[model samples]
Target chain A: MSHISLFEFTQVVKKTLEKNLDPTYWVVAEIGELRIHPKGHCYLELIEKQGEKIVARMKATIWSYTFQNLNVWFEKITGTSLKSGMKILVNGEIQFHESYGLSLNIRDIDANYTLGEREKIKREVIMRLEKEGLIRMNKSLELPLVPQRIAVISSAHSAGYEDFSNQLANSAYQFHISLFAAEMQGKDGTKSVVEALKNIFKEIDLFDLVVILRGGGAQSDLDCFDTYLMGKAIARFPIPVVTGIGHERDETVADLVARTRLKTPTAVAEFLLNGMRSYEESLLRSYERMIGHTQHRLLNESNRINHAATGIKSLSHQLIRDVDSLLRIQQQHIFDTIQHLQKQNDTQIDHLTGRLSLGLKSNLVRSQQQIYGYEQFFHFSDPEYTLQRGFTYTTIDGKSLNKQEAPTIGQVLETMTLDSTIKSKIEEVK
Target chain B: MAKELSYKDALEELEAIAHQIENDEPDIDELSALVKKAKELIQLCKKKLKKTGSEIDDAMKELED
Candidate 1:
């Protein structure tokens, strides 16, 4: 117990540490926490855990010069920059400062260790999700035929968001996209993404799918996407989720759990547009088929109508011809009957005229005989003829003509026989 | 006619009518009517495909109060 001041003791300890510890030592540990100072120094809490217990912990620092070089070197090797929660093998020197206590001054980092750690974690997450039957959950979801309504989960200020929006906006198909802004990287990224997913879930009916998007980044930026929370959120989401986290190499757990995975935000937009385009093609095809079938039907109907019309026309024509022939036959029959009646009437009139002429000739003959008889009687009774026949009548002074009358006076009478002439008077006796 | 039906429904109906006509089941009168209906449905479907509304309404949580 030397009566020395605290400053003197701190100086002696610092000297002892500088002399005993190696200038640079290789150490393996996990970066439990990390922060960057405004001046470009990186401070870290390095930890080694056994099961759930922290067995060792130490403070570490990388000056701006080393940090910048190491950061570039590490990113070039592993496709990612150093980040918290990553297991790293670092080369550093042990330093003891009174004010800061024991710390390590890091000179170099092994990028392979961090890369291996990320891969291991990703494999574990995949295994866990697979065992829980969630790996294929999102992929099995039936995407809408027209996935036009979209819920976009991304950083509003990120280039990925701009690319996605621009691509969709420029597409020919119309899409309804509602952006749900979220942190895309760092320690709080998982929490923010999960929150955005929850927000989308609340209005699940409004969206056909969820798109998780981010621009190309170092692999370290994708760490939050490999977490169990993110995997679970995307896998179990009611609406299918599509991921375009923009990593060129290894697929993140988010990518594996999504319904569709594309390389970039622009690709995701294209995928959505292609879906709409294919649907439209199908619609056009259906329409074309309908039109073709309708045209065929119309043609058939028109042909049928034409056929019927022709049939009616021919049938009517035949009917008219048949009717005309029948009318002609009837007219011929009526004319024949009229001619026959006229012939019968003419024969009757001829017969009646012949009988009338014969009756007139017979009557004329009988009248001529009667006239001859009368003429013969008159000739025989004539005086000349009586004289020739020697038949005579006598009269005394005309008394012979008054034989039956009493003679009132002697009268001169004359008698004549044959041609003899006598005069007679009518003195008469009985 | 087909304007009352949704694009999907109109297409479906058109398919059915076409099927009927293809089978030659309908009489001339019915066929004519079906053809007319199919024409209307085709027009409706084309309109649906060609006509796009420019109204874009956003309900983003970040934009909402």
Candidate 2:
């Protein structure tokens, strides 16, 4: 067999491919490798496989102008840029270059197909995670009431980081923030975030939550957040993870796997601050409850004391009144007894007076009889009897003289015997 | 008083005392003592709320070291 020169053979093959193959053919393939040239062209190695076996492979190109339009349109519809591992439905032309060999010149891509493929992959990842019970693992973690210790995963100089730090620093409560710097987007984003997570895991006890932060960007910039590896890492992390990737539209796999998902870095900080504020409010509530309970208790105590005091006062008053009544009754009894005794004594005195009066009257009657008899005797023994019996009486100075009497000089004396009377002048007598 | 009690414990005790005072109608002496204890617990809780600073350890520095 006569073989033509290799270059001539390639030229013939290129011409034949151009003449026979359709200028534009729709193809379905997976992007195995992809590179974007600095001059704005895209090169891709496309492959079709059956199970683990690659059945077909081809080199593909998209010129800069075509690539720019297609990229924008694809991303607009699918919310992601074309990247390796994405299955795409593309419109391309079969080309055989004399020097570059067989390739496909891609003219257009179906954004809906790629979108569907991405959804299918995402669904598969979610299903696998659900089956393994990992999808809800981080979400089920109980965040502390006050999650003050934070492990931050973000680009060191990202605006998201700045926003997060500023918001947290301005919060009413202090938070302990330790930044574990990581790339926030592009192909390396997932790996950097996973690595940061691993670092935080080394000292898991020191952190309450892991915050993955990124600022707002094109929706395609969030493609890294949907990767299975990052989702798995966040889902299985010991500490709860909070994501604030600043994507307003899509809920990435990282968001679903994390414990909490806020829309922005500032929102995440607000969430944390709100948590602390609620705790503080609860504390204040407890304080208020305690004060209310104490005041209620004190008021009750005061009321009880007043009640007891009133009870004692009234009881003492009743006791005093009862005693007073008892004393009065006793006084009346004693008065009655004294009055009875006085009446009895008065009656006895009257009886004794009557008896004494009777005795005196009888004695007086007996003494009167004796006096009568003595009087009669005395009258019978009068001086007449004596005179009749020759008895004489003598007197000096009208006073009778006896044998022991002596006369005084210059004084008249009288003597009487019975009825006869005599007067005598003073005479010396011895 | 020398043995330190945690804020939660102090609040718990305060709650218990309040309940006892409310329900039992304790005598004056016991009531006064309970009131004084509740006051101390309130102070302890307030102090905890007013705590000014926090202790932070950067474990990332350990990795750098």
Candidate 3:
């Protein structure tokens, strides 16, 4: 009973695993220590980590045919280049090998499922960064006033590389960018890109932004960007990364971790150029506004000065005209007084002649007519008539009010008539 | 409302929108709609990214334990 056959032992092991493990299950892990046997067999060790601790571990293998088909299918569906340290989901038959212990014989893989898992993982990481305030901690990388120095990562002959370099060169701005060519596809691509990035970081003093460019590659080539290693690297990098992996419907891990993720290398170039253009436009607008404001202020001041000058001219002219009119009125009054005095003198002389002799009667009649003329002049000069006809004069501060003798309260009070001063006070308080 | 699509799904939708905007024969109206959709998709993306980020942090803390 103790002597068991090797076949029986092997059968027991297989049966036990089949009974213990679910027939259909999902496993999420990072691809690690992958190796391909010469016999067209692919062997891999899958590992999952929680922080620094290895929480999950498994050995996995795929036959040559299965591996090839799975690889092609994954590439076609996800456009991701698969490699070590790539986060993946495996849906496969769990098998127990007697000789090799327990190992998962992977039958199929779902690229979308793994991508979803990766996203979930990425969200968790971002949240942690936020909680720790690390999201903004690495945010102090200054954008160059003119982003001229570029560190480019891509295949040497890649269309993306060519487009990036060409567009930058042909641009109005002549940028100084250095190219670091690496594989942009397959397992080796991830390693090469990481190495190139490290080197770029070492010489980071020479560059402004790091551009990871891949142009027009099949979705299969995109796996390099989807790798966990790539994402983690970009996330912790010292410089800002701009990813343009050139896929329409897929975003890689690298894209998630990048500061800017554009659809293509050409788009990245266009974005940079647009930034510069906008800055220039802003400066021009501010300059124009400044000039307009200055001109407006100057014009306003000039108008104010002209208006003030015109006002002073009008006031001076009016004052001068008023003084001339007063002078004419005074001269006419003096001439009238002299003419009356001459008429009075003639009348007195003619009356004396009449008394003296009959021969002078005619002269006396002439003098009488002159006396009549003088009477008319005296009537014109009568102050009593002028004062009786509602015309009154005032001396010093006091003037004619609405009533003959009504005084304006709160004024310096004084009064006069044409001949003499009838000095009086406001006799009653009322 | 649509089950709040997962980050990967939203990202795919965003990419589709971006492609439509990029390839359409320079139609301003169509491109504008696509851009609007793309912006929404970006919002969805940021939300999912934040969630996943937290999940990772939790996992990391658990590992540290």
Candidate 4:
């Protein structure tokens, strides 16, 4: 077996580290920690992470003079100071020291590359959210007809909140806004905002919507909102979220996931007020239509009634006139019939009276003739005439007797003729 | 508002139409439509009655049989 000295083994390791790496190469890494020594040398802990797990980590150093130049250049280009948690692009050499272990000797950093890295991270977070199906989750939530109750995630004293309040005050609509104070910037901002959303979810019934407002801060502070954690929080929230980030730059991940992304806090307030105004206008229009329809219906109904009344009046009047004419004709006919009948009866009565008088005179003469004839018969049939003609008869005492009469002893008999009479006395009785 | 009305609604519309006609407010162009509507409503009512009468006849036949 062969063994080498500790110094000899370290030299071999040092040679491998040096020969294995390029002289200068660009690296992408997040600054996990940063510090400047009194001597003006900038020390940084460069790290690469997958979610919360650190996959790679390295210590990097910039020389005193070079630190000054790179910091200034980066701040000028990115509008952000060198700080922890920022992804940086640094061109550096890998150095191995027998005593010191391994370190990256950072020579120069590309400020432009840093900016591009930030943009790339932002796009990656968006892609991740889209793949998770959370990009449109919050945006798809239905906004209430009137979002009166609002849960605000913002600093209580932020200038953006102040502007939002002032805008709402100007509108006639009333809104109930309550602040759930949270840090709106820095590394903790994403967590702060996520926690605020959780708190709102717990009291979700009390709010109609959630509004995350941030403004009047350095542009670099808006970076936290572009993170996957912040976007996921807003997208998965049950209630609708509206973001008014008040930035002139492109929309952040939070803005994309929100129900609406307004340019400023004042614009958000105006959106609410305009919705109310349109709803009110529609209601007023409906009321007007109701009145118009009702009045039209009543007018037409009354016209119909008037028309029926006039028709009824004319028809009844015509019928009454017809009945009146019929009655008058019947009355004239009855009067004429009575007059004709009376005239006929009077004529018959007069004729009958004349005939009766004539008949009575004739009957009286006939009766007189009948009585004269009877008197003639009586004169011709007289017993004195008959006896004077040629016949004699016997009488007893002063009575005439015939053969049927017998003489009595005490009777005196007498024969009488028309002008003379003889008397006799008899004694025999038979 | 729909094109087709339910039986009760059709009856009400018919009554309103008759009232409108009695008012004589429709112009000649509208009068043709109004009269056509009246004919349809009357036909609908008669058809309903006919259907009811058939139903009653069926029921009586069932009972007799």
| Chain A TM-score for predicted structure 1 | 0.69
Residue A136, candidate 1: Cα error in Å is 2.1
Q: TM-scores for chain A, candidates in order?
A: 0.69, 0.73, 0.51, 0.63
Measured by TM-score, the strongest candidate is 2
Can you write out model 2's per-residue Cα lDDT over A1-430, one digit (the tens) per residue? Answer: 9889988888888887778887799999999899999999999999998998999999999999999999999988887788987899999988777778888999999989988888888788888889989999999999988998999999898888898999888777899999999988887999999999999999999999999999755667676788889899999998889999987666889999999999899999989988998899999999999999999999999999999999999999999999999999999999999999988986786676666555655654564444344334433334455556777555554343543256678667655556676676776756
Give the clashing pairs for model 2: A393-A416, A393-A417, A395-A414, A395-A415, A396-A413, A396-A414, A397-A412, A397-A413, A397-A414, A398-A414
- The worst-scoring run of ten residues by lDDT in candidate 1 chain A lies at A370-379
Candidate 4: tens digits of C-alpha lDDT, residues A221-293: 6788999999999999998999998877678899999999998887888888888888888888888898899
- Highest lDDT model number: 2
What global local distance difference test value does model 3 have? 0.71
Per-residue lDDT of model 1, residues A272-291, tens digit only: 88888889999999999999
Q: After superposing candidate 4, which stretches have Cα over 4 Å from the reference?
A: A1-25, A35-43, A49-81, A91-108, A308-430, B1-65
DockQ of candidate 1 is 0.00
> How much is the lDDT of residue A130 in candidate 2?
90
For model 3, chain A alone compared with the true chain A gives a TM-score of 0.51
lDDT of 2 at A56: 93
> What is each candidate's DockQ, to 2 decimals?
0.00, 0.00, 0.00, 0.00
Question: Lowest-lDDT window of 10 residues in candidate 1 chain B?
Answer: B52-61
